[model samples]
Target: GFPGNYTDHTIANAAALLGAGRVVGVHRKAELPNYKVFDEKRYFHPGSRPTVVTVKGFRVGVLICEDIWVPEPVRSARAAGAELLVVINASPYECGKQREREAIARARVTDVGLPMAYVNTVSGQDELVFDGNSFAMDATGEVCMRAPPFVEGLYRVDFVRERGRVVPRSGPVAAELSDEASVYGALVLGVRDYVTKHGFPGVVMGLSGGIDSALTLAIAVDALGPERVHAVMMPSRYTSQMSLDDAADEARQLGVKYSVLSIEDVHRDPRDAGRGVRGAPGGYHGREHPVALPDAAADGLVQQDRTDAADHRQQERDGGRLATLYGDMAGGFAPIKDCSKLLVYRLAAYRNGLGAVIPQRVIDRAPSAELRADQKDSDALPPYEVLDPILAAFIEEDLSVEEIAARGFDRATVGRVLDLVKRNEYKRRQAPPGVRVSRRAFGRDWRYPITNGYRRESR
Candidate 1:
């Protein structure tokens, strides 16, 4: 019992959720993925149970995520007098997986001459985002009801009615949604549930007028509503008037409360703190490693003093690192804290172009952290179009430096980008968990040691 049966625990949990006489059935995952950062094979036993249970006088068969990927579960469910199939899954979010699941599950119903009701969980548990795209199909092989993707709802579908198999008569579900739409759905649902369940009424974001913040703000407004949503433009001197103006505009349009809190004061406070009663700057430095800055200066990159940099880094310097209380200050959670720079831009554009669209001023503004004077995102990061691809290769595909070089990226640029990503692992670790649309995410799917001594060929 030291290791414990996760399968048994899972089954029991389902039973509790459905309650007594509800005929809750738990199907364990028969196949496990255990390579390149996955180790499920080391944990639980392969599922052998595939029987149907009668719930409320309706015969139901339940299967886990991976079980029905093959044909055995469907065949067994039909063989067990199951007229309606209910699948409880914990499938991860890969690019086009929600649509694929719908196709695969619908086919199973048609192939077996039974109805299927699929239920999925959502949220970023480490690396994977379980998009709850629950759906149902009748015995005639027609999809009757589909719960929206990237959300969680306990709505009922008439699997069979009047003992005559009266199917659900809901409106047509949205089909052929864009990939971004699917990704956005997952993020919004995850945000909604996480905030609501955690007892947090709503969320707030530091809207920088960049795609990431815009998307995050939009998603937060969507999930928690404009009333609960809050936006803060923590602009520094380098933050363009364009960005600040656009950010403030989004808050107004959404009807969310907007605040302008300049981080310049905190940046200035730190330098004074270092010289005054706050003790020496080195006093904040204990167990600290110089990972934030590069040794060599190239491409106009220079070590802009960390005194006004990250409060977390400052805490680290003080031998006591702490995350900046941005969320706490605004009294709301951050929705897309872990979203990549490039995806942020694209998502911003997508939101702005939708329905009424975000104003052109927001999209046209340059990206900046607004930490100092004349600071541009290009000063801290490479062009997103260029940077995102390499990040996708390295983070999503797990490609190495040489492999990326073979893809026609400049070797020096690749090394620099890779280094920036690696060095910022600590920051990424501190970031709020975002939606995991890609195969490999910032946290779960991709993990490398932070204190590595290995150098790339360019070095």
Candidate 2:
């Protein structure tokens, strides 16, 4: 592999300085990959050749992340008398990525007729979460050992020579996490690391009585503990009493500090108050009442930062139109912003299972922005049950409108949903960074030109 500048020269110099011997390295490929989610071509020149070396009395093959996905590299390694395969990876985490890794490793080992040990990095870098699901597979394409996913540790693997052939000795095998569990764990780890590593004192989020906010609050508490998390309820004209009660109940149960700051005065200006979000001003107007705090001072509540409507009204009167939705949207972090509406419900259920924190009604109630009178999410978009899969197909799976419609969705509805997803690319880009759990999240993985004229209808 090319190590940036001076490649083999640097390695040789370092090896000589360290008194090393017999360092074999792969040549850089002539061409690099330039595709979705990858811009490798602009980086290092590709390795033009393969290399193998003997390590600890075993002839081992070394391959980088992308090389193992193709067959020719391993074939060349085996041709060079390699008895064992060791792959070093900096693979990013995606849905079912570990399973896919194992499956690919099994295929390579079966092709090369050798035991393989795969190593991967586990770190949450920006929007990318690298799951360390390193593993080893026998020549029979069976996983003999596996390191835990989303955890960092030193794992020891024992290999014994049996009848003049090296075979991986049975070792501790970590059970695969269920899909929901794996995703939930990734979210927790991602949030925990991001908040703590960045040295944020704590986090604050608007605690609407919706599934998205409910799930986000739970994640914040779980990641940084209730003491470091704060929830604010900014109610407006359309806010429901049930929403107020539920939000307060959830805050109390989670032991996170919360406050209710009514936006009633701000909502007096129907033009700005009717719409409660960033776009389409006057499209929504909602409010929720607050409950008395158990002990705001003791909970480390910052009084000056309270979601007081008077301050917002003053700011708005001073030509600060953005202040209208600031109380509801302003936050250091947002956990469920990346999550779809349906996924929000699923995550709420998942968190409650750990311990019933989110109220059942929050999960069961119809989702509404409460921006306008009697406005529900259904008023603006298709039902999440129908919309999520369609969105996933269009965005994640890259399915065309017809392809998605062929999966039992109405063509017109799929077309509409696709249009919404495409039109919202800019909004998603502007959203706060959250955990990336899906195969293709709205963050780094879902890059599309916001001003593009391309339409799925042509396909």
Candidate 3:
């Protein structure tokens, strides 16, 4: 059958590396570990046989990544008189996959008396990282070569049997990197691939000069190059001189376009609009009605009205101000919209980097939303050290107030914390979408009411 006309027909180009030949075999992805990370079943039909290859010299057969983890794939390939086995893969990296693969491949090769070439793709997608450590072995079951770890590389081996030397000639090993190095590498790789794959012109975001923005700027610069990154410092009246300064420093360090546009005026305009927001009848604020209150009726009657004040204030509240309202608009993308204060700082520390790019001052300061006069995040929420863990418990762990209190937190504090969380549902609902890094994120795992009579669980 013609390649394009085959539906549910799987075929491998057995002759891609060989002469003109074809191996028409139906093989589907074997594993669908659809947990938090993988989605293979949704995309592929399970490969029927592990190693069915098109007739080619060397009796070569193929196995997918997970298929070779078991015996059937290798057994079938060997039964077919395959002298050399090639396993193409999108194997996810867990701890020590190389060592595990060595053991698994050794078992497969020894049982079959066949040389195996393990070719794993190298890159990051989602939480999974593909460390391209593609390797090979000899028919005598000796490892011919080991590819470098966590990289993109092509390793070719000259299999010599007539000469009787299975010795491997190797290429450069991309040096082993630290866990931080590995994670950082993964983020950069994922960012680059995603942006390029999605056909984005480039990325634009706030360069808050704090850790999160600093790290983000560094990442963006690394991912798309400095020329492609546009960084803005959309400061409010409360934006400390340090914040403004540090954001500038980050943009400089990352070599991206940087600018500051104060949102103080923007902030004030919104606080002023709190009048409309408050009095708008039924918007977010306003008087609660029974079946019908005049105020409630008035609130729902929002016309196709556009207030420069309203747009400006909504922009400040909804994050459009950082671009549209504030005009420090970097480009068309935003990264750290609702990230907690702690991560923001940690990211800054990360940006300090292998070199001292981010300033220590950014790391050592208290975090603030800086949207109002004399403001700090602590003004509205508890300090992150105190607030973050509690948020983790209440939001992520789903611990009741009593359980949270039991963890050495004051009962009063716990009660207040829960109240704040419930109260802030409106803000969280209105806030810009933030990248999720927690076991649970506010946007998805939670659905609560803005108007309710239910008090604390204890009550």
What is each predicted model's overall lDDT from 0 to 1? 0.57, 0.66, 0.54
User: Which of the two, 1 or 2, has more TM-score?
Assistant: 2
Tens digit of per-residue lDDT, candidate 3, span 1-459: 111222546432221233455435534444434433444455444545444554433456766676677787678777876666777777655434466777888888878777788888876553345767778866555677767765686677654444532233443333445444544555566556556755655665555555555666776777688886666566544457777778887788768766665544534443555566656533332111111121121122212111000010111122111222222221222334334455455545565666777678767766544444454546555556877677668766789988998898878777777776665555545443333334445444356676778655532
Ranking according to lDDT, highest score first? 2, 1, 3
Per-residue alpha-carbon lDDT of candidate 1 for residues 1-459, written as tens digits (9 for 90 to 100)? 012256346321121115385625555555555654457777666666565776777777766665567777788878877767777776777668866887787678778877777777756553356776677767666667766756556767664465655355554453646866776776676666666666555554456665556666677777778876556666544567777777777778888877776655544444454563434533332101111111111101112211101111111111112222222112223345435555565666667666433666556666544444555557655676777787778776778888998999888888877776666566555554545566665556566676768845433
Overall local distance difference test of candidate 3: 0.54
- TM-score against truth, every candidate: 0.71, 0.82, 0.62
lDDT of 2 at 224: 76
The candidate maximizing TM-score is: 2
Model 2, range 1-459, lDDT digits (tens) per residue? 235445343221011111146445443333344654567766555655565666677887767777778788888878988888877777877778898888888888888789998989887765567889888889999888899988899998887778887899888899998776777777777777777777666676667687667777777777678988777776766778998999999999999888887656644654444464645554333232111111232123444543211110110111111122233333444444445666666667777888999899888888776665676767666776887787778767889888988999998888766665665555444445656677766656566787866655532
lDDT of 2: 0.66
lDDT of 1: 0.57
Tell me the spans in candidate 1 whose CA falls farther than 4 Å from its real position: 1-29, 32-44, 53-60, 71-85, 92-94, 103-116, 121-129, 137-145, 151-173, 272-334, 354-357, 453-459
